[model samples]
Target: MIPYEEIKVPVAGGELAAVRWPAGDPDAPVVVALHGITANALSWGPVARLLAGRVTLVAPDLRGRAGSSGLPGPYGIAAHADDIAALTEALGLDRVVLAGHSMGAFVAVVAAVRHPERFGPLLLVDGGIGFPAPTHLSPDELMTAVIGPAMDRLSMTFADRAAYRAFWQAHPAFAGAWSDEVDAYIQRDLTGGEPAMHSTCRIEAVRTDGIGLFDEEVLSAVRKLPVEATLLWAARGLMDEEQGLYDEKRLAAADLDGTRLEPVAVRDVNHYTVLTGDRGGREIADRLVAYARA
Candidate 1:
């Protein structure tokens, strides 16, 4: 695994705990990565390792999750977008290849729209395109249906770090794709002592952000992006189901206009493995390196 360092980034409410993988060269291209709603910076570990010093990667634990869980929120996609903008400024990054996975893809869209000058090419993994909100279901039900186990874990406690690892080990998506990088990512989300440990993700934050996924601003934010974006979608669902998040029919329905946003299908991976597995991580890292170099 490539070496990385932990750092703190000043954002709106408080400092955002982050991880940085240096590229050694001062002039190396930089990629600012964003994790999913209930995920932390360590989720990018696999991709970082695959990059192999090609580009510097900075991934942050957005407010209300993991190391930044203590930070107050006003949490949602838009709020996270603002914090991302702040992160670039704090680090003196005038332009960066902005990449996001899952919910982070939503945040990337809003951030690019809000601060176009700060971003270059956008790499959206397994998310960013908007899904039609169901009207029959209430907000809570909708969240449970969409977020599934990720949201459910927020309210559950584990006996220890080992227990937390076991929970993720059993997830269908991670069954055959588990690795040391995946384990580290899982362990980073744990908080509190043994017998009472739980995910650092805040329920309120997940609820608000899950709701924001369907917001008009978020749904339409992609249309307003200043730069081109490449969306990498998994072939399987979150639970390793046959149908993944974005298929040709779904992408066609979204009406991307085939100009600014390009959707590419990644086979044999799920939402989680698309960032954690070797195949998916290599694909994503290659694109990031190419874009950053461009």
Candidate 2:
């Protein structure tokens, strides 16, 4: 397995942890990958492995997931975008190819617009476009509507890592795509030991960010996006159904500045496996490498 360097970035509440995977070339370009709302930096492991020795890839734990979960509130897409901006600034990167999966993709768009000078091109995976909100719903209702199963899993506790694996093993998304990397992602998310093996993602963090997922802030950012961005969405929905997250017709209808946004549909896989499975992960890694080189 490829290794990574852990870093702590100072933000408003506390420190945000980041992981840097060396791409084996001193002159290689830098690429920063962001995880989904409930995922951590390790969510990019499969992608990192595929791109090893190609470019220096970095993944931040964001504000409230895994190693950085303990950081205080003031969480949201805008806050997370600022954290990314602060992180890139602290690392002294004038510009980086920013790639974000799921909610992270939304964060990338906001960051790109807010700090255009910090990024070159954007690689969005399974997110950033479909702000499909059922009108006038509460935050809880919004979370249930947008990310039901994923949102529900946050509060559920498992007996052990084995059980946790079993829960996901039965998930339709990983039907035939489960791998050691996925096991690592699952294991890393488990905290509180055996008796109370709970997800490390903070509940409050999820609540705060869940509300932002359907907010106009992200949509506004996408509308005003100034740089080139490409979205790669899966063929299946979050529950591994035939329908996917971003509807083609809906996305096509949205007034996403054509000059700034491009959407690519990825065949096979669902929300979870899009970046954690072998084929989808490599596809994303390849795109990220291409983005870095361009």
Best by lDDT: 1
TM-score of each: 0.98, 0.95
lDDT per residue as tens, model 2, 92-208: 887789999999999999999989998888999998875557778877888888778888888898998899999989988888888887887777778997777899899888888
Q: What is the lDDT of residue 135 in candidate 1?
A: 93
Q: State residue 200's C-alpha deviation in candidate 1, in Å.
A: 0.3
lDDT, model 2:
0.86
Candidate 2: misplaced stretches above 4 Å? 257-259
Model 1 stretches with alpha carbons more than 4 Å out: none
lDDT of 2 at 30: 91
Clashing pairs in 2: none
